[model samples]
Target: MSAATPTAPWTRTRLRTSPGTATALFLLVLLTACLAAAFPRAVDRYEDRGLRRTLAAEAPARLTVDVTVEDPGLELTPEQRTVRVSDPVTHAAYRKIAASLKAPLTADPHESSYGTRSAEPMPALDRWLPRIDGPPTQLTLNAQGGLADHARITSGRLPHGDYTARTMEAAVTRDTARHLRLAPGKVVHFPDLDGRPISVRITGVVDPVRPSGAYWSTAPLLRTPEQRSTESQPPTHYWTAALLLNPKAAAAILYTTGRAQSYWQLAPTTDTLTARQLPDVTRSLASIANGPGLLSVRTATASDTADVGSHLGDVLDRYTELRSGITPVVSVAAYGTGAVACVVLLMAGGLAADRRRAELALLRSRGASLRGIGGRLLAETAVVALPAGALGLLLALAAVPYGRVLPPVLAATAVVLLACATLPLRAMAAHRRPHPHGAA
Candidate 1:
């Protein structure tokens, strides 16, 4: 009988012989630690804009756009000074633009009422009138900031229809109504800028916003000295009471007042817009800006601006930036560390396994089955990898925010197993167990 060959312990014996193999496993754990350290910051930067859960939940943002006064010198009609964006011509133009872009547009616009306040006081009743400063102002609610949609009416019904110049009804804020002691169904008289008598019956009251509970202005009702030119003298004008009217009514008021005294609000149809579509929107609005009697429109809307529209390039740009943003140095460090670790593990494992070919050959000669040898080697790999994975996880927790844990540990284990498993295959492939005397 051939001499009984001792069974080479696949795991313990292999490790005892090749201590250097641990270096590859240690390097994998170190790389995993590096990934863990950088992961939180990377994720945080991504979440800022890439996936906006907040925006999805909130209503679409609206922008305020001030219609710049073109002929501050000429006493032009509001219809003349400002293009009626809600009119058929402008609406059709926007529709064409929308159709061309294949985008949904919210046609609702907030056209401001441009009439002057009725300077004449109410008929004397008692001494129950609240003290009010500044001139009374008339303003119309356009598509963007309509009374029925945004405001809460504390009393009475809101004025119906597209605020026609003919609908002699008006909605006042709670503060304005309280100040004038005006109630629903009360007829109020006011003079247009041309001193034309305009009588509008109070229809409802809008709830004031917040702790002050005061409705100051339908829009900014203050006029400073600089707003005046040689044509517009007595520059300082104040608006104490604001009347909210629809576009048609506002146009009527504007016609009576003979001035474009307010801004237009603009917004896209959808709640959100993408960066790719901004250029088309900007161009579409450019057509309107070039229309008759309208001044050049601004490309970007500011926070204070009343309209958010014409394709929402600014908002889209912000979201795009968030999605694409990367941590400049950390991104490279984390990825590079992982790739290098993989390469190192594979090379070191192969070398260590090559050295253990003799041990595998000895096991084979001892009648140890291939399945048994593979099992032992695989178990040995798990033993090293599992502990290294745990250690890597601990290191990661200490280094980075606690938001992450499992990914690094799992990654470390996977890397170690891959490296260790590859070793056995390379060793088996290269090994040649010499046939014993008289054995095939």
Candidate 2:
């Protein structure tokens, strides 16, 4: 029988020969890969946390779209001119404007409030005592969309539909009622520009469930009365408040006042927002403000002069500025850490290469080709680096899973490739130099 063929030394045996070096190299590679995979994800988490905090603390008015159209009644068609203010056709026109204003908002968990208010304040007078005149008050006829949801009736009940009646039903806040000494069943009158007295009967007193809530921000004056004084020998104190009226009375208020301002408040919930959606939200807000969305709303409502106002863009801009200020600092820190990691990795690789130099030289002397020796070194390093890198990446993902996958994947791949290439390149360089004893 032929002699058993001699087999080359196993790769496992070579690795087992220097268990300490292998363990150290594996640990170094694992740490580097873990940091590479974790940095971006950590940054993303930090940014998301900051974004949520900023949004939660911001006022509702800064993040809502407030659309206002003045004197919608003046845009009535010739055929619509003869219709009564309480007619369904007239109500439909105002509803159409509200629908147009709400059409552009596509964000989830959003709320809207639309109403008509007299453009100018009228002096409020008690019907029973004509001599006592109180502060100026504005009449606002609003749909019960989110009003009842955010306010609680303390005295009577929500205003009922009395659009066709001579006196419209209204509700006043607890503060307003107290300040004006008004209560349920009290009759209040305001003289319209047409010289006719517009009468309203208070049906209830309301208190806000959450005074600081976004819903209240839509109509601040309704919850908190405004106080103003003129500069004179004795400053005359003036209080302004808004009286909430049934939605059905919108056309009557507009018609009686001759000109009224209509408002649509669109408030998007901050809880539904994410850092990834920042750019999209900003663009959507901008589109609603001046782009095709605004044009479409104007065209649909047939109100060419309607104006859309929002501070959402400005809020997003502040966020961008904050991010920009922080990004460079984070980049510099990452670069510094990466440079230090590279230096440490290079030192470790150099040590490992130095340790294997004698073995490599001995193989070269035994007629092994330089390519063969370099290939063995590369294979050994890859055996340790690739799996360690993968495990590190898995650990990072399990810890903080928030950022784009591509960046972390590329970082781990680059680290593994560098680890694989380092040993072979260093070995090849050391072998190429001329030996003083002319050996191998």
lDDT of 1 by residue, 340-404 (tens): 86777677668767666666777777787776676777777766766766676566666655343
Give the backbone clash total of model 2: 0
Report how far off residue 304 is in candidate 2 (Å).
2.0
**Residue-pair clashes per candidate, as listed?**
23, 0
Model 2 agreement with the true structure over 1-440: per-residue lDDT tens digits: 89999886656877888788888888989999999999988988888788878867888777777777777647577334324233353345435534443323342223555556666666665433322223344444444334566688999998875564246888888887887677999888776656667777889999988777666765677676777655775666566677887665565565455356666666765664667778777777767688876886566445788788888778778888999999999999999999998888888878878877777777666677778878888888889999999998998888887777888888888888888888888888888743433354
Q: TM-scores, in order shown?
A: 0.45, 0.83
lDDT, residue 392, candidate 1: 64
lDDT for model 2, on a 0 to 1 scale? Answer: 0.71
lDDT agreement of model 1 with the native: 0.47
TM-score of 1: 0.45
Best by TM-score: 2
Local lDDT at 312 for model 1: 41
Which candidate achieves the best lDDT against the true structure?
A: 2
